[model samples]
Target: MKKIKIGIIGGTGGIGRWFAQYFQKEGLEVWVSGRRSGPDLPTMARECPVVIVSVPIAATLSVIEQIGPLMPEEALLTDFTSLKAEPVRAMLRASSCEVIGLHPLFGPEAKTLAGHNVVVCPARSRKWLPFVLDLFRKGRARIIETTPEKHDEWMAQVQVLNHLNTIAMGLALKRSGFQLAELLPVATPAFEAKVEWMKKIFGPNAGLYAQIITHNPFVEDVFENYQESLRELKKWIRRRDDEGLRKRIEQAGLFPAVRMKEE
Candidate 1:
């Protein structure tokens, strides 16, 4: 097997840094690069055969435009942006290289890729497909291939809704004057699990969450549904309608049956 040389643009960011470290651990010649002066990018891409753009969603296209022409002709270019359609379109317009869009469902905090899911949106090449799949397989990551539009639509629920719900839970706790740790003892296992998720969401950069919610078009509907659900819950509580509340609970109970079985 030929050793792969990887270049990561926006290497200063969390995702990019994680990729650089992971690639290095896999014995690949990995180089970290970004727009800022902290690291050397051109030289790195010049030597690497695979280039990954792990910048912000808003900056992804611009970085792609800048890096596309400079990358070696045979280098495989990909991105770690949450929304893929726009980046895929941009890369298609800007470069003739083998472009792909990737979304790692896990965060930089992830210890390993053993159980993690990665979305791969291949654009313009069958030759590089196996190589790309093999790279992720080496880390034991599950690769899910799909179109860029489908990837973004799925992320609206996976990333946006999940994060928004966590944010809402934290907000509710704040407004209710409830200390999270204090509720742990009396909480059910499900509620406790939710609190743990809240802790993870609140622990890190707010900017990442902001980008996820703001950049994805489908997120607005999720937010609207969240607000509507809260309003209905509030109405049910204020009205003290036991029948209505019971019916609502029963409806919620049916949700699990409608959902896909967990792996």
Candidate 2:
């Protein structure tokens, strides 16, 4: 049996490196490429039947623009970009190559994909669907097929809102002159959990978080809702309006029930 060759653009990054290792572990011949000028990337891309662009969201579109025409006509191209719509659209416009959008719902630090979810948006071909699904299954990942629009909407809430909240928590702590280490002993379980999330959010490149929030259209509404919720809470506290606060809490409880049933 012939091994499938995969070219991973931006293979030096954390996610890309993981994919390279994952593909190789699955017995696929893997090649890695970055934006640096070289014959190696084009050579690898041409030779491979599948190419994955794993660059940052900001650079993904541009990289697609550059590599689109160069990729072999028979090659199947996919991306690991967080926001899918833009990159998917760019690839659609740039090439006749079969394009797909992939968003890994977990971080690179995830050791196992036992409970991890990967979003897949198929474009241009049904031929590659089984191959992509099999790849994710080999990684022990749950594949969620969705349209580009749905992926971006959910990602805005999942990635942008979550990161923004964590960033805001860190900022609030800084303003309050609170040291994280000092709070650990006194913190509630929920607070400790939030702090753990904050550690992950703050540990990596800040620019990634910036790109997620900025590029996603749904983030502005999310931030607005966050601010409005804060203001409403403050108003309830200031007035000592126990009834108002209780009503708000009751509404929140009902809201999730509604969403849960809907989903």
Candidate 3:
């Protein structure tokens, strides 16, 4: 039997390229497009049975707006973006094709899907849902079925807050004017580990992280909460309120998330 051809917009590099390699390994024919080369957007939209929009967060909607109208009704249209709500909505509005929103929880640098999670928001999909999900299962990926709104809300906490914390630390280090060479001599295991991990985010994934932080609708609340925490911590420090600080620390250890009733 002939393999289904998959078209990935912006698949020449990064996560799109990773998906191309992954699908090819599963015996599917893969075609990719980018600004510089490969197949054009309308051609990929019309030719492939499954057309995935894998452009950067800032460009995802624009690409979807242009190509989504070009897709055939029988084709499946999906996007691999960190924040799903807007992209999924655009796909639904612009295309008559089946729509699914996918956000691979890990970066392209990951060796394999293995234990990693892939969040799937099936917006308008019926027929193509099983096929797309089965492919992820074959790659050993844990599938998280969720609504686009819920997924974006969760990512505001997961991606936005996490990246904010890391960026804060990097900023603090810069303001302190402490050379890494000086810090390295006495760095704790945890500090060194964070430094190394953050280097990857601050390096190649820097723009992507920035986009995720800024594009998500729910991120403003996350930032407000973060600022409030900082102010509260500063107040405690200024007062030298050891008991207050201890109580705050204890409250955080409660891990309220783990205790939430499963939906």
Give Cα-based local distance difference scores for all models. 0.82, 0.85, 0.92
Best by lDDT: 3
lDDT of 1 by residue, 1-263 (tens): 87787888887778788888888888887777767644455675577778888988878888888878777667788889889988988887877778888888888888987878999999976577788888789999999999999998898888899898889878988999988779888999999888888777787677778788888879878888888888889978999898998778777766685444531
What's the TM-score of each model vs. the native?
Answer: 0.85, 0.91, 0.94
Pairs in steric clash, model 1:
none
Q: Identify the runs in model 1 with alpha carbons over 4 angstroms from their true place.
A: 34-39, 178-191, 252-263
Please report how far candidate 2 places residue 133 from its true position, in Å.
Answer: 1.0
Output the lDDT of residue 35, model 3: 86
How would you encode candidate 2's per-residue C-alpha lDDT over 1-263 as one tens digit per residue?
99998888888777888888888988998888866833365686678888888888899888888888777777888999999889999988887888888988877788876679999999776678789989999878999999999999998778888899899989999899979889899999999899888877687677888898999978888889899989989999999999999888877875787767856
The TM-score that candidate 1 achieves is 0.85
Please give the lDDT score for candidate 2.
0.85
On TM-score, the stronger of 1 and 3 is: 3
What root-mean-square deviation over C-alphas does model 2 reach? 3.0
Q: Put the candidates in TM-score order, highest first.
A: 3, 2, 1
Q: Which model scores highest in TM-score? A: 3
